[model samples]
Target: MLEQHATELLRHTVEETFPLAREVMTLDARQYTCPERFAQEKQQIFSRVPLVLAASCELRKPGDFKTVEVAGIPVLLVRNREGTVHALLNACTHRGAAVASGCGSAARFTCPYHGWTFAQDGDLVGIASSTDFGAVDKTALAMKRFPVTERAGLIWVILDPDSSHDPADMLGGIDELVAGFGFAGWNHIESRTMHGPNWKLTFDAHLEFYHVPVLHRETFGPERSNRAFYFSQGPHQRVVAPRGRPGDTAKDDLYALGRLPAADEPFDPLLVGEWILFPGASINTFYLNGQRGVLLSIVLPGPDVGTSTTTQTFLAETPPDEVTRAAMEELCTFLARVVGDEDLPTSALQQKALATGLLEHVRFGQNEGGLQHFHRWLDDLLKADDAELAALLAEPCPQR
Candidate 1:
């Protein structure tokens, strides 16, 4: 059972607080970098749960389709004539050849190796030599399909047919948390993908603001202070740091560098809000004056252990003008570079050490309460017997 105090605190923070307080803490890195644990995590995290497979933006119109690889399974996502999004196994039933090549508009997909075709809805439509086969049941040979659902502008897929789980239930407290940000009206402006040492390692680097004063001194150091940082945890974990006053010493350098616009009005008081959604999504909010924008990052497991991909989406209330858009792009690019150039190397190095038995376990601190909560959830899932796991999957998300 979830502790009563933790559950209450989560409900209040996610529902009531706009900029909540921060608690300093740390998480043991050993669990993530360990090879034996990584194998267990694959079955627990990737196979047992539904994951975001594609974005709705990729299949915005009928006949549009996109192909993606999910944990080594080739997936084809298509928008049928009725406009519903469907996910299908990409293999042709004839000889398991992939029916489609790249993202494009297609009423139907035809296998090039042999002449087999399937409709956008996964109906087997053709066979190269029907006469050669003696009354083969075409309906029985239709391409396989996977369960898919769309929410918050992204498409989610369940790989295991026998696994009983509800996507909404798995989303936990994120629905209310996202609704609180008024994101329904926001438009998707851009998306970028980056290769990382490990998805969880990259997430760990972003889960706390403790690194800002030290690791990000060259970039955000002048505009932010360690004392201004605050942390909160619930179903979602958040760390916030307000920009210092205009005339503070830290402000002079940031202003002189022309990175931040001169404070024409009082600081909006909400400078930065970083939220870590359970499982593997991170949402960030940035406030300059009264202008605000949100960045959402989703990390997914790749084909094997030690590899993963991070997909980021930038969104805003209004479509940005060239200048504003450029700034936003630059901001995301800089952050991506920091992760790729700095964090990835360290994480990879740690993975190597862990593989060689150099590290056994990692510890978490009080401020890193969010990390602790996340690991606890992981451990719970891993340790759960089959019966307990099923019960967890069936339970409804806690009410706000």
Candidate 2:
């Protein structure tokens, strides 16, 4: 979907690696904040990447469905009577109107525009006037469907007509990384969306642990050490930070910090794991033994400059013990606040600078290797010739 010229620029900008010790990384500023580049990314990144689009599980039973948008394309996710998940264009074939308005369970969808109806399986079950239409092939009029693949408890979709890559293949090392956390049995909890700044900025904020000690000082400052952050590579980049031990504090202050009973009660050490899928998907997992959870987020491009949306879904072990579920909910709420209240505002400010054109480039330090790897990957994607890009995009889906 990216323009030819912007792809060329992205290729040219990402050709060099900035060394961080023995690790080589690349950083490209234009790709992040440039309007033309952003447009190109919407087409190439969001459309071609299955991991960004297809991911779902049953909220209830058969006939359950949810509607979502990717990059700007409206999508309807439905579980048919057979319990197989299907991703279909949300638009009605009748007049291109969205068939379903919101997320809910439905036996069938009828277009408000013309009374054309579709079964839960996306088949055209009724035409307002079948006999009057005379020999119109209803089977051929089924809702346009996209490719959907389910893996590791998530459903992924590919929107591009020419996309030949499998979501699992593009996921590369992320498959094993996710397995390391035992995510297959995780249950869906809640999801929230935040709008501000570009999605890339939100992802950039998560790609490093350097900001943890500073940005999270009020909550985690006393317990965490900045130097403890470390990174590892797979299909994507991963950063792990060990939770810090709480320091001396008054009893009331301890209660306010969510640490009760006593300071010496020996609380579980926290582990924050982050995954940066090539392009712009970020998944952050937090472990606290009884309070394990994961946050899957995507930075989807809007229709203008300096704008993007962040959609986050929180999942935990389902059918959980009441206490564990309650605790996980509280923790997820807290994390969402940290992102909505703290990180987004800062990212918006960064977008302001990017739009003003006063800054041509942003710098990355040795500690931000994940950020560099993401940029380099983007460079490779944009620079690749159509054939090469197609090959990279069409890599076979990993076996579930």
Q: What is the C-alpha local distance difference test score of each model?
A: 0.63, 0.63
List, residue by residue over 162-278, the lDDT tens digit for candidate 1. 556655555554444444455545666677777766667766676665566676677665555543222333335554443423453332222223233335732222223466655
Query: Can you give the lDDT of residue 208 in candidate 2?
Result: 77
Each candidate's root-mean-square deviation in Å? 7.3, 9.9
Question: Evaluated with TM-score, which candidate comes out highest?
Answer: 2
Tens-place lDDT digits, model 2, residues 1-400: 1122123223333553222433444445565577788777777667766645424543446788888776578889888888788788888776798899667798999999888899987899998887886677788889888777666666777776456565555555445444534544667777777886777787788777678778888755644645323343432554543332344232222222442233464321122245665556777655444455678877766666567778777776455677777777787788778888888898998887777766777876666666665665666666665556545644422211
Score residue 176 of candidate 2 by CA lDDT: 48
Runs in model 2 lying further than 4 Å from the true structure: 1-28, 53-55, 58-60, 131-135, 180-184, 227-235, 242-272, 287-291, 390-400
**lDDT over C-alpha atoms for residue 7 of model 1:** 35
Q: What TM-score does structure 2 among the candidates reach?
A: 0.79
